[model samples]
Target chain A: MEKIKIEICVGTTCFVMGASSIQALEFEIPEDLIGKIEVTESRCMEFCKDHKDGHHKGPFVKINGEVMADATYDKVLDKVRAIIKKKEEN
Target chain B: MKEELFIEIGSAYTNKAGQDICGDTIHFKKIEDEMRTITVLSDGLGSGVKANILANMTSHMALKFVESNMDLLRSSEVMMDALPICQIRKISYSTFTIVDSNINGKTKIIEMDNPPFVFIRNQKEQVIKNRTLTSPKWSERSLHISQITTLLDDRIIFFSDGITQAGIGTKKYPLGWRREGCKKFTLSLIKKHPNISAHDLANEIIEEAKRKEPNNISGDDMSCAVVYFRKPRKLLLLSGPPYDMNKDKEYAEMVSLYQGKTAICGGTTANIIERELCLDCEIDKTSFDKKIPCASIMEGVDLVTEGILTLTEVYRLLKHNIELKNDNAATRLTKLLINSDNIDFVIGTQINNAHQDPNLPVELEIRRNIIKKIVRILKENYLKEITIKYI
Candidate 1:
């Protein structure tokens, strides 16, 4: 199966909003999902600039082509597992 | 009419071995509005605090008088009469050399009781004629004055007696390294690195002078100052994202079209450039400092760093004139600012909400404030020409 791509935004807003913790996903990937996921860093995806109302939101991550906002370590990990499981079933 | 050359002045000094402060003083002022520069180097009669005060007073008075349009010869005379005499020695003594130059034209050098300034042109020492001026008030003293039109790549190097007299009473040189020795050494340096900066060249000469002393400790306060006429070095610094997202492409275009070295100081700013210019930004994981975030690499950008944090660190470094040691983002940025003669800043007005949190450290000041502080220091302290544009 083709690997799922993960691009984490390491831009200033995202990094300060806890993207650094999500970056650790590279080292802590579950054994089942290790080889199936390819992780990379985006200097910024500019997702934070597209805010709802007037509030700026960040710490974004993209699974394949889908972007997840306000991302955390567990949220990113669970998303990666779900993507990998779906790819297997398909 | 001759085109104006960027005049780069660099100076270095070492204290008498046991003293914490250098007694030799070097001061320079660039009158930007007038397109001129005045540099003064003074060495006091003795070593330590008293000498420091004497040298400091002489250089300050000399610089101020010249800046006010006083005649260079008259200024030297006034400075001489103003200094107090050392009672035991029965001499009011301090040596000074002043180099006053018009950026687009000729340079006038005045020397009194210090080693004659060394003039280098085309990688060779060029001889210039000097007229001796003596004031009847101090008939015992004479000033050597020279006026010459300087070309690109010409360098004027002057130093205190300590530099010329290093290693006195030693077997290597019973008579010490005189003006001839200093001149010969400077010529050798220019031959080796024809493009060496005024700062590095002056530093190298001081280091060599120190080595001539016993145990590599200078016996007296030593100093060397160099003035080089050359082309200006340019740098562009981009930080923050544009307030209007639509302007991102224009901002990125500015980076692409700039002719000199470029640095991006914020992540979102880098992202805008990466996207609009179709360039890749890579994280540089090899070096890290606990205080500063790690730097990133990009196709055309010379440096990439986290915005507020790295800029705050840079402001502190420039404000205090701190010496950089680590290979982190802040030091790299500081070094770039120091080496460049002209700096242009493009700052985005976008507000980062994450930085507005009161819980954040106090050092994380607003981006505009930090850049303003950096600009003031670069202009006033480092004598750099700077321009800023807000997007």
Candidate 2:
């Protein structure tokens, strides 16, 4: 199975805004997407706290290093689905 | 340290005044991490407020001394010398009964100025041989102190003088309720409800003591504490649908490996389990109420019920002890939980959007919140080991 690496920032700022939900992605994955995704929590994505431009804020998820800003439930879901769908098509 | 123990303490005291305060004090503390349990019940010298204070002080000191690994009899001696003596009776102000038990089934009971403790094994009173030790302060004052290795299903009941002294001047019995009477009543009750929980049994005995009272006015403060040794009955509860259908096999395997009773909650989750395990579920047509859905039965599953509503009802019944018949799945589930010693909840993370339907009369709650609330209540009130694992 081809795996899509999913990175989630679990730093203090990100966690307060709801990044812990990202860690539960393993339980939230759909049937077709279960084993095909490799989820990891990065201490800091350098997007939430230290980003100078500030386009990407806290509670962020990065699929293969592509940052998703304000990674709410729907936002994270969309990013994960995109990666999993791409792998399925391949 | 891992052995299961059930401790129940109940008290009934009649005050000279109509106030609710009973002079007798019952205190129980369990250091689960340390595998030690201390139960102290003290009856003060007189019936009212002064007696209450003395009882409280004795029990408080008794627990502290026992926790520090002081010898039981020696500790009693210290307590006797420390407390103020009664001018007329020439004895300690408060009389106490202490039951200190360790995880290895070693139980030490020390009683000073109270009645002898009763040991019941298999519905019959077991005669316990205790050594009479004299108080250091007063050589004439001797008390009963016993040590025993508790066997599984053994029950030790200790009470204040008020219990055996019930109905002293009544026509029913010119003499008070004696040790023999107490034993007979306890044996009869145990015979009728053999598997009664500790809380229920303690309550029954205390209520009986009150019944034996003349005109419901107890002569003294009454308290009863019981310790029952039994195997832990574990229950596994599965609720909600798995987020990934592919993980159903893993979930089913986990359920199959559990050593205790299995309960499947939610229609979708049950169907998923049934599909993965290739089991058949026969739905019960009988409805307990309209609020909750009908129950179903799978071959190996102990309980099967509809999702959120049944769970909500179970949570409500546990939180607020309402009267409900056990004919339906929800109430039966409640009964099973109350009787069990340990419970593990395997919850699925998939949100049921349908539960949030606008037409529903009750407020919609997510499964995680419901599970958390139920776990808290079961742990705090029922004293059960509850663990939650997400799928």
Candidate 3:
């Protein structure tokens, strides 16, 4: 199985808004996907309110160099599955 | 007149009675002669009014359940199941603790899963136990109170984590009063004033904590239960078929058969038996189970609290009163009752169930099997003489 890197921003702005869910996602994912996913807790993703959503509107996470904003557990899982599928196609 | 002992009761509130943020504490003396007393302290998770409601609900439900009908173990199970849970939010939870002590100086303590309890005994402090992530977040910790027999007089202390978090004495860590710090403080108090009443000591500790740090922390809704014991009384327990209204009379008759003044406990039927038999009875009010009738009659007895906790309390009561000696005795008696050989007749009943679909009995079997399982566990763990009979 090929490995995919996952970065979760624990930045003060994101954390204050709703980044708490990411830590939980780290543990909830199944055992088969454990080593396949690398979770890094970074201090700041610099998500500005000036973007698509309003102020304090983010919990940004990156999957294989693709940035996903307002990331939720389900959204992250879907992205991870897609990433794995893309790898298999190659 | 036989000397009837009364439990001293008292309460202290944060504001004058009928105020908004009512941080109040109520405690009663241990049920006479039986060194055991149950103390419940609930710190509603939030602050101000919402906190008050949560705290009150937690303490009221826990006390009413434990003190009235259910034993410590059963009450814990029922309350944990009953508390409301919000699936979306994780932090909205109630943290509570129960400290049950016996006069012979034995104590059993339980803390819910959410907020863990700090056990401070003999100048040593430690977290009671941790709850897994699977447990409800509202329930910080539910600890089985460890037994403390050697202490000359045991004090089952409980307080909301707010007291520990206040950073009064020390604040290097976010968690305050700390299990170790509280333990050392309590032990020092015991050493300094061996005769100081528990009530006064609790107040002193609060005052000292407040004086140490005056940081807008209004002593996070404090409450504690200070229990002491002198002489031990034997425990007497009995239970008939589950939800068997007719068996109430049989239980009353059995209590009457015993020599001591009986405290008949049950619902309306148990009350009826008390009237007919002319025996004392008291209702176990702590239970939310509507199936068991309400009412017990009592005469000149010091104190009467909950009736049968579960099949287990029945075992404890029988052991202390009848002296069955060990597992062999309990097993033999259980075999007799299960086989219906010893008792001339055995009765069973059914309860209304909304969830039953196809082939399940509305009411599960409540006889010697459940009783025997509890007895076997107790006998294997601790040696006690208790026996039960079914008819």
Q: Which number leads on lDDT?
A: 1
List residue ranges in candidate 2 displaced over 4 A: A1-90, B1-25, B44-61, B70-94, B132-143, B188-196, B214-222, B253-258, B277-300, B306-331, B354-365
List ranges where model 3 is wrong by over 4 Å: A1-90, B1-19, B23-30, B33-35, B68-74, B80-92, B113-142, B168-175, B215-219, B229-391
Winner of 1 and 3 under lDDT: 1
Q: List the residue pairs that clash in candidate 1.
A: none
What lDDT does the true structure give each of the candidates? Answer: 0.85, 0.74, 0.47
Which stretches of candidate 1 lie above 4 Å from their native place? A1-90, B1-4
TM-score of 3: 0.38
**lDDT score, candidate 3, position B154:** 36
The C-alpha TM-scores of every prediction are: 0.86, 0.64, 0.38
Model 2 Cα RMSD, 1 decimal: 14.1
Q: Which candidate number maximizes DockQ?
A: 1
Ranking by DockQ: 1, 2, 3
User: What does TM-score give for chain A of every model?
Assistant: 0.86, 0.77, 0.78
